[model samples]
Every structure is written in C-alpha cells, then in structure tokens.
Target chain A: MINDVWILATASLVAISCALVGVFLILRRQALMGDAISHSVLLGIVLAFLISESRSLPVMLAGAVIIGLITAWLSDTLHKVGKLQSDASIGIVFTLFFAIGVILISLYAGQVDLDQECVLYGEIAFVPFDTIIWGSSEQGLDIGPRAFWMISVVFVIVLASILVAFNRLQTVAFHPSLALSLGINVVFWHYFLMTLVSLTTVASFDAVGAILVVALLVIPASSAYLLASTLKNMLWLAVIYAQSAVLIGYALAYALDSAISASIAVTSGVLLGLTILGLQVHKIRLRRQGKATLLEKA
Target chain B: MQEWNLIQQPGTWELLIEFWSFEDMNALWVLMGSILLGMSASVIGGFAFLRKRSLIGDALAHAALPGVMMAFLLFQTRDPLVMFLGALTSSFIGFFLIDWLPKNTKIKPDTALAITLSFFFALGLMLLSHIQGLQVENKSGLDKILFGQAAAMTQQDITLLAYVTVFILVAVTAFFQKFRLIAFSAIYARSLGVPVALYELLLALLIVMSVVVGLQLVGVVLMAAVLLTPIAAARFWSDQLTTILFLSAFFGALSALISTQISYLAPAMPTGPWMVVSLASLFLLSLLFAPSRGLIKRYWQQRQLRQKVSEENVLRTLYKLYERRQFEQNDFNIADIQALRSMPTDMLKDTLKHLCKKQMIRESMRGFCLSKEGLEIATQLTRRHRLWENYLNQYMDLPADQVHSQAERIEHILTQEQEWQLEAELKNRKSDPHGNPIPENTEGMSRDK
Candidate 1:
C-alpha cells in the first residue's frame, strides 16, 4: 500500500513539473522541442553512466543538459545555415542523436545501467526499491522515493524560475522584438525555458521514460491553451489537468492492467478530445441563445 | 573462462571474410533487404522533403505502432503481412487526422501531429504492456520492434520487404509528375485543373507505404530519419528534382551497404542506428563538401570574390592617382594608395604582388606603377565606375558624391555588356557630373589623345 502511494506521488510530481514547462512551449508553439530533448537525453544518460561508472542523479542531469543544449543549438544552426526547413532540422538532429544513444547502449549493454527497453518505456515500478538513506542503519532517514525527491527539486526550480522571470518569459514568447526593446534579454529567457525543460525531462525519465515524457509535456498544456484565455490561468489549468490525469490514469491502469505511463497519456489525450468537444458545444449554445434574443427583440 | 571465451571469439576481419564468402546466407539476405529498403524509401521520401512534410513520416511511423500491437494481440501471430496491413490502416487514419485537424479546428498542424502521434503511441504501449502481462511464449522478444534487430529479420521478412519495395517504386514512377506538381504548389496545381486533393492523398499513401515497410528494420522512432535524411543530403548536390531523387537513392543504398556490413561484423550492434549514423555521416559530408551548395564551396567562392574586388579596387585607385597628377605621373607611392582606401598594408602588398604576377602592375622606384595592360584595365574600371555614378545621379537622382560609394561596389560586378547598356542609356555621356572624365574602353597601351 505504501509502495503504491509512493508510485502515485512520484508520477503526479513528474506530471506537474512537465506541465509547468509545457505551458511556455505551447505558447511559443515549440511543442516538439520537448520531444526532441527527451529522446536525445538518452545519449546523455548512457555517456554519463559510461564516464562516471555510476547512476548518480547529478552526473546524469549534467550530461542531459549538455546534450539538450547541443540539440537545440544544432537544430537552429541547421535551419539558419544549412537552409533546411525548421521542422526537418529538428527531426534530423534529434533522431541522429537518439540513434547514437541506442547504438551506444547496445554496444556497451552490460557496462551501462540502462537497457534499450527501459530507455523506451522506463521501469517506474522499481522506483521504491532504490532508496536513498540519510544515516546509519540504526538511525537512518528514509527519504521516501528517490524519484519523488528528484521530481520535487526539479518542480521547485522550474516554478521558481517561472515566477522570477514570468514577465520576461511572457514577452519573449508573445513578442520577441518587444522583449528586446524592453531590455529583457530575450535570448537568455529562451535558453532559460529550455534549461527548465531539459531538467524536468531528465528528472521525469525515471518515472515515465523518454517517449511518454513528450506526452506529459505537450498534451496538458495544449489542452489548457485551447480553453484558457490567459497565461497564468493556462499554467494552473494545465497543472490541474495533469494531476487529474495522474489520479484517474493510475486507477485506469490498475483496472486494465496496463502501463501506468501509457494510461496517463491516454487519459490526457481523451480529456483534450473532450475539451474540444465541450468548447464546440458551448459555442453552439451561445449562438442559439443569441438568435432567440434577436428574434424576440425584433 | 566464459569471459575469456567471449574475448577470444572471432574478430571483425574474420566476420568480414565470412560475410563476403556468403558463408552466412542470413547476412547476405539482410544486406539485400536493406539495399532495397533504402532505394525505395529515399525515392518516395523525395516528395515528402520537397513538400516540407518531413515530420509527417515521423507521425505516421509512431501511429503505426498501435496497429502492429493490435494485430498481434488479436491473432496471436507475428506474421509480417498481418502487421503490415494493420500498420497501414492506422497510418492512413493518422495521415487523415493530421490532414483534417488543422483545417477543422483551432489546433495547429504541429499540435495535431503531436497529439495524434502520442495518442496512438500511448495506445500501442498499453497493448504491449498487456501482452507482457499475459506471459505468452515469444513475448520476450516483442520489444525488439522498438529498436529493431536486423538479425531477427527472417527470410520471409526479406521477401515481403522486396515486394513492397517494388510496389512503392512502381507507384512513384507512374505518378511522378503529379506528385511533383502537388509537392511544388498545390494551389497552382488546383488552378491547372489537376485533382490536387487526390494526388495529395496519393502522396500521403506512398509515404505511409514506405514508412511501414521500413519500420521493422529502422523501427518506429527512427524510421523518419531513414525516410528523410537521404533526400536532405542529396538536396545539397542538385537543384533538379530528378537528380536529387536519383542521388538520394544512391546515398541511401550506399549507407545501407556499409551499415549492414558493420552490423554483420558486430552482432551486438543493431542495424537501425548504424544505418542512421551512416546516413547522417553522408549528410554531414555533403553539407560540408558538396561542390555547388556545400559550405566549403560557398566559402571558397566568397573568398575569391573578396580577393578579386580588392585587386580591382587597387587598379582603380592607381588610375585615380594618375588623374590626380593630371595624367603626367604613371606611378604613385604605396602609402598614397593606402590613404585612398583604408586597407591593411599586408593585404595591399599581396594585391600588388598578385597584379605584378599577372603583368598588370610593376614596382617602380617610388612604389607601384600600372603596366600598359594594367593602365587599359584600370581605365575600363574607372569608366565603369564613373558611368554607374552618372547613371545613378541622372536616373536614380542621387547626389554625385553619394553615388561614388554606391558605384564602388557595383563597378566590380557590372559586366562589359552592362557598361555598354549604361553608356547607351545615359546617352553617350563622356564625363560624370562630378567633372571626372569617363574614359573609353581601351586595349593594350592605347589612350585618348
């Protein structure tokens, strides 16, 4: 029972952190950037593991940030210098990086802490087993779940960054030239948001793998963007939506005997579909009411 | 002992010999299959690249996964044909959703693609996990589809891939012109009374077919790279669509040959990444070194143009110096020329040396002098410069002084024919408005008396 509690908490924390960064991505119309970063970070993990000979969090996160920045920079260069289409550049760079990661993992299969399977769909059920103790066995501190702690730290950092630079991020996303005119350092904010995304994606990888992290990062914020009118409201709504997906998806996964991460993605997708349908229905009702009022007044 | 045996196993050279001798027919079949896959994918993918729908191949690949898992769950079989049909059905549906969503909804195309891709992939993951829970025989290896093992490809799989490759190639050939029309401009094709919508759907269908066939080898995640990278690299080599298509196929085939060989030698290495890495290497090579559009070529051209412009500027300056002396003096100090154009002394020296090598300029007792041929070239440069300045002043209505700076850059680029056109257009004007004489085009040592 406690293990299930830890799992739910870890998954929810992961979902919330992803949704927080995803709001900016949706506003910037860079929804696929998360997808690109998440996949290429696998290479980072394998390389870090190879070099450090350990599965420590800081080393993995450091490697992930480096590769994530490279993916972003390389894609931008390909678009500007190579004159390739923006989307094609993104597709090529990420896939090439990801393929390299896969090759490395397979070639040094036993030497690394990862397998190809776990990289694709992570083993989140094993989260509770890997505990981080704070002291001796006689009087030790059980830190709950390592994934939970990692997601918590990532969530705090992302939230604080957003709160601290909310205006700059908003101006940069909506009007980069205006941000520049306002002396906002628009490029710095752009990389700032990307840093948060890389950090959140790597932290969440232990719980949801790389592919489903793309889902967690994109779906909720996109759904909220469709419904909410303001940026602040969208952020809140996305968090709520993501948290609801986690709870409901956990239950659904329990009932159906399916993967928890996949279930969460399915729930998010279904909710988005419902929101689309509901918005359409609301517009139709408003139109009918407007027509009746006009006829009666006439 | 076990580790020792593993380390003592046959090395790469031995494996290469075996691969060449065809001692392992499996390797031969895998190689042949990859070659066909490469050729057909790149040919069909050309249209996708041109239309800027490169990522659509990615979405289709992801969307096909659910159908493959569904087929397996239903039939309890791993028949390639069954999986192919299932993947095709889902891919078509996905293509439709990606096409239809943006047209009908507030959601943009990229968002729609992301949603559809993740939605279907999530479904596939769900089903796959269920299959895992069932503990059925052979369920252990089903995860291999995610990253694809070429060694796992059977003889039947290769045969199926061959037939699909032939079908895709023939279809693309038959509809080549129509595909080209839609890819270039759908609205224009519609204005021409072509069935644009039908051809668009046909092209999407072709993308789906190629993506599905290559899925087992390249897997769902990286299949789009196989579909798109060859054409991207080939684009650096040619602007003509036909040549690009041909070159794309050749690159695809070549990468497949090398990657397959590597995979055969190192059984531990998977084929998909090796294929993708090889293709990416080819792309980087073309991006850096292809003759026409490569970075090195463009850089070289720019460098040559810079050198030529500076050289020409020096000769024009020498002519102006002669004019300053009222046409009596034929040589000027190097420092005087340097004062005229604020240039590096070393660059000026090299420019002077280059002119001397070409017999355009010679070192005088004071500094530098224009040779007879050099004087004629300098006269033409000065004439072109002054004429452009006059044209800009009279037609463009600019101040004569402002025109000099504008005309300075244009003088190097204007051809002799353009100079004549300028002369005629300006109605035989012999002198610029700034009171500078525009000399006639002369040869050898000839000068106006």
Candidate 2:
C-alpha cells in the first residue's frame, strides 16, 4: 500500500510537470513539438549515458535539454530554411533524432543501462527502489524515490515559470505577433517554454519513459483545453485531470498487473473521452434550457 | 566503448560485403520488404503532403497499434494478413475520428491528431501490457512494431508488403490525374465535378494501407517520417507531380536499400531508424545540392544575381560618369568610378577585369574605357534603366526620386519584352521624369580596343 502511494506520488508529479507545460503547448499550437521533443530526448539520454559512462541524473537532464533544444532548433530550421512545411519538418527531424537514439542504444546495448524496452514503456514501478540518500550509510535519510523528487522539482519550476510569466506566456500562446507587438521576445519565449518542456519531459521520462511522456504531456492538457474557458482554469483543470489519472491509473494497474505508465496513459485518455462526452452533454443541456425559455416567452 | 570495437572485427567487412551481395536469403527478403515499403509510402505520401495532411500518417500509424494487438488477441496468430486487416480497420476508425473531431468540435486538426495519436497509442500500450502479462506465446515480438524490426519480416510479410505496394502503386497510377487535381485544387476539382470527397476518402484509405503495410518495417512512431520525408526531399528535385512521385519513390527505395544493408551487417542495429536516418540523409542531400531548387543552387543563383547587379551598377555608373563629363571621353580613372558607385576598389577592379576579358572594356595604365561594344551594351542598359524609371514614375505615379530606386531593382530583372512594353507605355519618350536623356538604341555598333 505504501509502495502504491510512492508510485502515485511520482506519477502525479510527472503528470503535473507535463500538464503544466502541456497547457502552454496546446495553447501555442505546439502540441506536436512536445511530441517531437519527447522523442528526441531519448537520443540525448543515450548520448549522455554514453559520454558520462554513468546514468547520473544531472548529466542526463543536461543532455536531454541540449538535444531537446537541438530538435526544436533543427525542426525550426527545416521549416524556415529548408522550405519544408511545418509538419513535414517536424516529422523529419524528430524521427531522425529518435532513430539515431535507438540505433545508438542497440549498438551499445551492454554498455548503457538503458534498453529498447525500457526506453519505450518505462519501468515506473522500479523507480521507488532507486532512492535518493541524504547522508552516510550509518545515518542516511531516505527522501523517498529519486524520480519523485526530480519530478516534483521540475513541477515546481514549471509552475513558477508559468505563474511568473503568465501574461507573457498567455499572449505568446494566444497570439505570437500580438506578443511581439507588446515587446515580448517571441523566439526567446518559445525556446524558454521549450526548455521547461524539455526539463519536464526528461524528469518524467525516468518514471514514464519517452513515448508515454508524450501521453502525459498532451492528454491532460487536451482534456483541460476542452473543459476550461480561461488559460488559468485550463492549467488548474489539467492538474486535476492529471492527478485523477495518476490515482485511477494506479488503481487500474494494481488490479490488472499491467504496465503502470501505459495504464496511466490509458486512464488519462479515458478521462479525456469522458470530458468530451460531458462537455457535449453540458452544451446540449444549455441549448435545451435556452429553447425552453424561448418557448415559454413565445 | 569496447563494444564499439566489434565493428572492427576481422570478418565484419566480409559479413557486410556478403550481406550487400544478397547472398543471404533473409537479407534479400528484408531488402525486398523495405523497398516495397519505401516505394509505396513515398508515392502515396506525396498526395498526403500536398493536401497538408502529412501528420495523418503519424496518427494512423499510432492508431494501427491497437488494431494489431486486437488482431493478436482475437486470432492468437501473428498472421500478417489478419494484422493488416485489423490495422486497416483501426486506422480507418482513427482517420474518421481525426476527420470528424475538428468538424464536430472546436478542436483544431493538429490537436485532433495529437489526441487521436496519444489516445490510440495508450490503448494499444494498455492492451499490449495485458497481453504480455497473459504470458502468450510470440508476444515478445509484438513490441517490435513500435520501433519496427526488418529482420522480423517473414517471407509472408514480404509477400504482403509486395501486394500492398503493388495495389497502392496501381491505384495511384490509375487515379493519377484525379488525385493530382484534388490535391492541388480541391475546390476547383469539386466544381469540375470530380467527386473531391470520394477521392479524399480514397486517398485516406490508400494512406492507411501504405501505413499498415510499412508498419512492420518502419513501426508506428516513425512511420509518418518514412511516408512524408522522402516526398519532401523529392520536392526539391522537381515541380512536376509525376516526376516528384517518381523521385520520391526512388528516394524511399534507396533509403530502404541502405538501411537494410546496415541492419544486415550489424544485427544489433534496427532497420527502421537506419531507414529513417538514411532517408533524412537523402533529404538533407536534396535540400543542399539539388540543381534547381536546392540550397546550394539557390545560393549560387543569388550570388550570380548580386554579381550581375553589381556589374550593371558599375556600367550605369560609368555611363553617368561619361554623362557628367558632358560625353567628352570614354575613359575614366578607377577612383572616379569608385566615387560614383560607392563600390570597393578590389571588387570594382575584378568587375573591370571581367569586362575587359569579355572585351566589353579596355584597360590602360591610366584608366578604364568602354569599348564600342561596351558602350552599346551600356547604352542599352542605361536606356532600360531610364525607361523603367519613367514607367514607374508615370504609371505607378511615383515621384522621379522614388522611381530611380524602383527602376534600379526592376532594371536588372526586366525581360526584353517588359523593356519594350515599358517603352511603349512611356510612348517612346527620349527623356525620363528627371529630364535625363534616355540613350537611343545603338545596334550594329562595332567593338574596339
């Protein structure tokens, strides 16, 4: 039972980080860019492990950030310079990056602790065993799962960035040219937001792996985008959806003994479907009420 | 790091050579499968890219995951045909959802794509996990579809790939003109009664088929790249749709060849990413070096234009200098020429040398002089420049000052026909709005040293 709590905690933090950044991504119409960054960061993780010869958290995060920025920059270059359409450019860059990552992992299969399967589905259940220690062996304090703390830190950073830059982010997300007119550096904000996404994705990747991170990043925010009218409401609602997904996904996985990360992704998707259905129901109810009042007046 | 040295083993090169020689039957099958996958994907993907629905492949590929799992669950067999039908059905469902969502709700197409993609992928993952937990035989290989395993292609898989490839190619060829019409101008095609929506549905079906066929090799996540990138790269090579489709298919086949060889040589390396990487390499190559629309070619053309503009500016400046000197002499010092055009000394010297090489100008120890040929060419240029200035001044209603800058840009680009049109529009006036005399035509003038 305690183990489930840690798993759910870590999953919630991962969800929060992804959802916070994902709100801006969906609003800025860069949902696929999140997908691209999540995929390419695998290459970063592989390279980081290879270069550092160890799976140090900071080293992997740094590598993920650099590669994430490269993916964003290269995709932008392909769109702007190569004259490819935005979707094609994105499709080309991330797949190429991800393929390289997969190739590297396969080539150095034994040297790197990462495997193809782990890179795909992730081993979030095992995350609890990788505890962070605070002192010497004699009096070391367990601070719970390292992934939990890592994602929590990232969640806070994402929250602070959004909270501090809300207006600028909202302006940039809603209307880039308008933001530019308002003296916001559109490119800087784009990359800054991307940096946050990269950080969030890398932190979540330890718990959910590469592909499932995309689910966490896009699904909650998409549901929120459907449900909420304001960006503020959307962010809060995304957090709500993400937390609910974590808890319910944990319960489903616990019952079925399935892959926890995938279960979480599935649970969130189910939540999104329900959200869509509910929104439709609410809309129909409002229409019926409006018609009834109109008929009474008539 | 020691693992990296395996490539340097004594027989590694020999193994690569043998693999590329197609002596190995497994290698040959994988090669055939990849080639068919590439060709079909690129050809059909051409239309998808044209319609700006390139990401539909991504969504469909991801959506096919659940279908494959469902096929395995229902039939308890890894039959390629069953899986194909299942993936086709599932992706069609996904395609309709993607099509319906944006129309029915306020969700945009890209958002719709992301939603369908992640949702279906999650469902697939959930099913796969449950399947894995069930301890089913042959369950392990199903995960390979996420990243693709070319070595996993049985003879049956190859046959399936070939059939689908042939089907897609035949259908696309038969409907070539109609597909092209709908892709390029759907509203216009509809007005002409071409049944645009039916064609769109057919194209979607074709995309779903190609994606399903290629899924075994390229996998779900990167399938869209295989479909779209080759066509995008091929676009740099040609403008004609037929040529683009041909080049795209060729690029796809070529990448498949290279990726399959690498996968064969290094068994540890997966074929799909290598295929993607190879495709990207070709795309980068096309983007950089294709003759017509390539980056290098565009750069060279720009440089050529800059040189021509500079050379013409020098000629115009020389004529102005001759005019300022009251048309008394043809020779002028390089410094005086520099003072007139604000050009760097060395660059101006090179232009002068180039002109002299062409025998358009004569260079003496003291100064530079336009030969008779140069004078005639320079006179024609000056007349065009002045005529364009007058045209812009008269027709665009710009002041004389503003017209000079406008004519300065237009003079270099104006064709002979446009020059004549400007002359006629200006009623063959001898003088411009600023009252500078437009030099008359000096045909039949002989060159002099």
**Proportion of native contacts kept per candidate:** 0.62, 0.69
lDDT of 2 by residue, A155-250 (tens): 788888988888889999998998889898999999998899899988988888888888888889988888789989999999999999998998
Q: For candidate 1, lDDT tens digit of each residue in A115-143?
A: 77677667678888877787896689987
On TM-score, the leading prediction is 1
What's model 2's lDDT at A271? Answer: 94
Clashing pairs in 2: none
TM-score of 2: 0.93
How well is each residue in B1-449 modelled by candidate 1, as lDDT tens digits?
A: 01112255668678788789998988899889889999999988888888988888888999998988888888888888988899999998888988876786677788788888888888789888988988666666566667666777888888999899989889989999888888899899999999987888788888898888888787888888888999999999999999999999998899889878876666666678888899999999999999999999999999999999999999999999998998898878888998888889999999999999998998898988999888888898888889999999998999866998888999888877787799899876779979988887774343222
lDDT of each: 0.85, 0.87
Name every residue pair that clashes in candidate 1. Answer: none
